[model samples]
Target: MKKLLLLVGGSAGLGEALYSHYKNLDYDIVEFSRSGQQPEHVFLDMSRKETAIDTIDLQFAQLAKQPWQEIVLIINAAQIGPIGELAMSEPKQWWQNIEVNLTLPISIMGRFQTHFQAVEAPKNIAFVSSGAATSVIEGWSLYSATKAGVEHFIRVVAQEQSSKSNPITPVILNPGIMDTQMQATIRSSSEAQFSNVDWFKQAHETGQLASPATVAGNIAAVLSGKLEAGQVYDVSG
Candidate 1:
């Protein structure tokens, strides 16, 4: 059976790029989006546990009916909000960020862990983390913290799998800064507060930012065992 690489955020940006690259490959490419436009892909709203789990369950149930070799979970779903100090930030926004960024991935992984384990084949799970995971950006506390938490969660999961003698390999990867809608959101919001907004905009316009295709290619390489497990690779540098 051919291995299955499932990308969880196919509606936009990195997830979309990954989906496009893998769609034509010999492996099966399944995507999950919040919107139902991609009828072929799973529709999931990670912010809501009920929606997220239901979508995931449906996908897994379908996969169970198919002859799949492995399962790969690409947790690329994220949302970036206004930049501000934690004390001054809106509590609701902070909670939303945490739910989307940190909690959702954990929940999805927990729900699917057993399903992946039951398979008599190798399994790989990768998290689309960020450079913000390691570096502290002044106004990106919520985003940065959530990313870091994800990386830590990946490491712990990997450790637990190893202890259990499971064949699952988990990795946390940083795709770096890309020319995507999220960057635009930052630039737009930073106009009043950040002097580097123009520089960022120029980078985006001039193709200085990493392309999602390139990131997806690197991820594909990782999936092919070109990259080692438990090591984080920065897609930019």
Candidate 2:
């Protein structure tokens, strides 16, 4: 049976790891990102809502014509910026962060459900959320807020799916701190900008950070296992 993997932000970090993992399994992979090293990557800027939705709509139109035994949509695109205190950060950047981390994911889920509602194949949607969603971290107000919002949105989606005869499985992921570009950004921040900068640096120096590939593998395992929809799967655990 042919399988399809539609991934967002599958250019680098854990997203890249997921792309490679599924590709190795001979799954037809299509990745959406702003820029990517892989030829399969389709440029779709999540920061621009309307354009991004249009792009996904076009892609879904084409994908609907294909026959697949299973289809998975994993949304890993996120922004972790405006790291400083909330009062000192620019409102424009905060809004952009919210759009990428929250708005785009929700929009994509809606589009996916709408387009594939009649498809008999098994459908799965996973969002790469963070532990920050439930924790309070200084200087990470926007990131935490948006992530929290994404988590709750997943729960709502899962509830809605419970009523459908053919429901899409929704999973929320808490991929712990990994040695990714996002971690590099966190480690690069000054103490003034990010109070936990030293802690992240120590994790890197002491080899406490998990590799993106390892986390990606764990996520794949969770998706394949007996997963309860809407529950947050922590890769570290």
Candidate 3:
């Protein structure tokens, strides 16, 4: 049976690249994103919890039989909004960022773990993380806070899944500064909005930013290869 590669946020950026790469490798790719282009693709609007629920419900049905040797999951979905200042940002927007980055991953991972518990094949799950998890950028209060939370959350999941007879492996990854649309947005930010705007702009201008495809390759390698506990593997290195 063909293995399944469930790609969250597969419609764009690093997600798109990973989907293409894994598809070529013959994994049964299921894309979950905001784009409702195909019936097989699960539409996701990260700002809302309902979309995540729907996607989980549908996948539960498909993988109910999870007859393949293993299922690979890559979570490349995140929100970088509520920028500028903590007090200046709207409560709804800031909360939504936390929901997307923190709550959604736990929900998805729990469902998959419960469903695949009996399966003997190891299920490797990876989160697309960033350096912001440990950074204190001036305008990224919401984004930084959420990333930090999930990084620790993954550690908790790792401990829970570490027991013998459990095939679930969780990996919290820091994919580094990639030349994605998010980087472009940072590059365009005003100095007041982002203190390091010139730094990012220079990275782009000097071709220092990593390619999305390259980072995706590093992610795919870790998720499909090994489970290094408590380590946040940075793809840049």
Candidate 4:
């Protein structure tokens, strides 16, 4: 029996960490991202929604031909952009953020479900979510909104699969504040652009941020076990 992991946004941060962890466990890893250079990595640019969805469709079609004991998907790619308030954010970047963080993932999920509907494998999916889904962070309107949209969409997907005997179990994983390049970008933002900039800076200075590897390990534990459909799992520092 073989196990496969279809990891989106597997180029950096928690995605990279998960890639390494699962690789060590001997799972076939098909990483999708623009930057990942692994032999199994499929180059995917989330900015181009139509092209990205096409690529994902092709990949899932190929994946459907394989026999597997388990298949897992972890969508960790996101755009933490349009950091400033809505009025001050650039239109092009704001739309790009929506494409990457919302539409693209949703499209990918739909394709995966349709393609693998008949596969009787233990299919699991975990969507990385955020506290921003529930918090109102100033100057983070676009980022916050996209996170909330994705999280709800995840629950909806789970709800749709709940009645299936071999359902594609989907869960929301909230990886709390972490020390990542994304956080670096947040810390570099001026107070005018991000009201909570100082808080991120202080977190970095005080070493309060969780390591990506640690968070990835916690997430792996959840994915490797039996998951309650539509449950929300929070991994904190």
Candidate 5:
């Protein structure tokens, strides 16, 4: 049986880096993304919450035909920035960010938990989370709140899966400040919405940010079970 690597949001950024690395590692890869650039990738529009769950289900059903010893789910899709104070932010966009960063992954994890409950194969679920999960950044109320919410969801998943006979490993990976397009978006944020915009701008200007490829390697380690489960870990460490 082959190792199956499932990537959500692999069209670009760190997710793309992860896909490339794991594809070379010989895992049978599956991707879910909005771009849908390849025939093998399952089309999943992060903006369309209504269809996301079903798309995941359909993909899972199709992949079930494969005889696999392990399944690793790496959730790298994030709706990072309509950056601003929650009250001042555009309502619809803010809601969508929450939907992408928090609701979507949780719902998908729920499906994974139920589907694999009876399967004895080793499983690993990892989320590409951020320090924003705990750090309160001014003008980033929505982003901060959603990241924090995601970590709590991780905690719950850890607890829920701990007692299973052939338990799934869950990891919340804090990949540090990676040099992704998301960083550029943060650098371009208005001061009114993101007070620490200058910090991000400076980071990029001085080339201080970590490369996505490097962080992607660290995340791969977590998914490979090099790190302990049910805990929050920083890749830099």
Candidate 6:
């Protein structure tokens, strides 16, 4: 049975790299993105509840019939908006951030759990959490809270699954800092608030920031059983 690697949010940085790498592998590669160009890919907007659930159900139906040995979900869809104190920030923007970061991952995992529980295969879920989950930085309350919530959710799920008859390994990962579009968006939005924007740009210009390919390789390694399950791996090199 060919292993199935289902990559969510494949149009962006880390997700894009994961798709590119796994598509060339012997295993079957399926991807979902808002604007995916690859074959066997579907367009999915994770922010919309109905759309997200419908897309996931369609994908699950297809996968359940296949001779797949494993399922890997990479939740990499994120929005980086203007930074400001929570009191000064727009309430809608904060809600949007929570929807994308926290709610989407929870929904994805719920779908995965429902689908994989019946399958007699080893199922693993890898959540692409952020360093902001633990570190406190000004003007990042929304991002930080959402990420931290995701990590805690994954941890609790892992604990519950450990005692189940059929178990799924859920890993909460912090991929560290990378030179991705999210970072670029953050730097571009309200540069005055993010005083280190210029420094980050300089790092990217000088090739100091890690490439998406590098981060993707680390993620693939984890999925390949090279890394321990249920432990957070920081992909900082």
Better structure of 3 and 4 per TM-score: 4
Better of 3 and 4 by lDDT: 4
TM-score of 1: 0.90
Estimate, for each residue in 120-185, the C-alpha lDDT of model 2 and write its tens digit: 888989999988899999999889998899889889989999899888889998889899999999
lDDT of each: 0.77, 0.89, 0.79, 0.89, 0.82, 0.78
lDDT of 2: 0.89
lDDT of 3: 0.79
Task: Report how far off residue 4 is in candidate 3 (Å).
Answer: 1.1
Instruction: Flag clash pairs in model 1.
Output: none
Worst 10 residues of 6 by lDDT: 187-196
Using lDDT, give the best candidate's number.
2
Error of 6 at 212 (Å): 0.7
Q: Deviation in angstroms for 170 in model 2?
A: 0.5
What CA root-mean-square deviation does each model show from the true structure? 2.1, 1.1, 1.7, 1.0, 1.5, 1.8
lDDT string, candidate 4, 94-148, tens digits: 9999999889878888998988878999888888988898899998888888888
How far residue 52's Cα lies from its native spot in candidate 2, in Å, is 0.8
**How badly does each model clash, as a count of residue pairs?**
0, 0, 0, 0, 0, 0
Per-residue accuracy of model 6 over 1-237 as CA lDDT, tens digit each:
778887878886888888888876765877877898888788888667678888888788778777677767777777655476767677887777778888887988898888777777778888888887898877777888888998888888888888878788888777777878887776675655665667767777887778888888888877777534567887654
Consecutive 10-residue window with the lowest summed lDDT within model 2: 228-237
**What C-alpha lDDT, on a 0 to 100 scale, does residue 185 get in candidate 5?**
82
Clash pairs for candidate 3: none
> By lDDT, is 2 or 3 better?
2
Report the lDDT tens digits of candidate 5 across residue range 78-162.
9777787667756888879989998998888887776765667788888888888888788777777887888888888788777
**lDDT for 112 (candidate 4):** 87
Superior candidate under TM-score, 4 versus 6 = 4
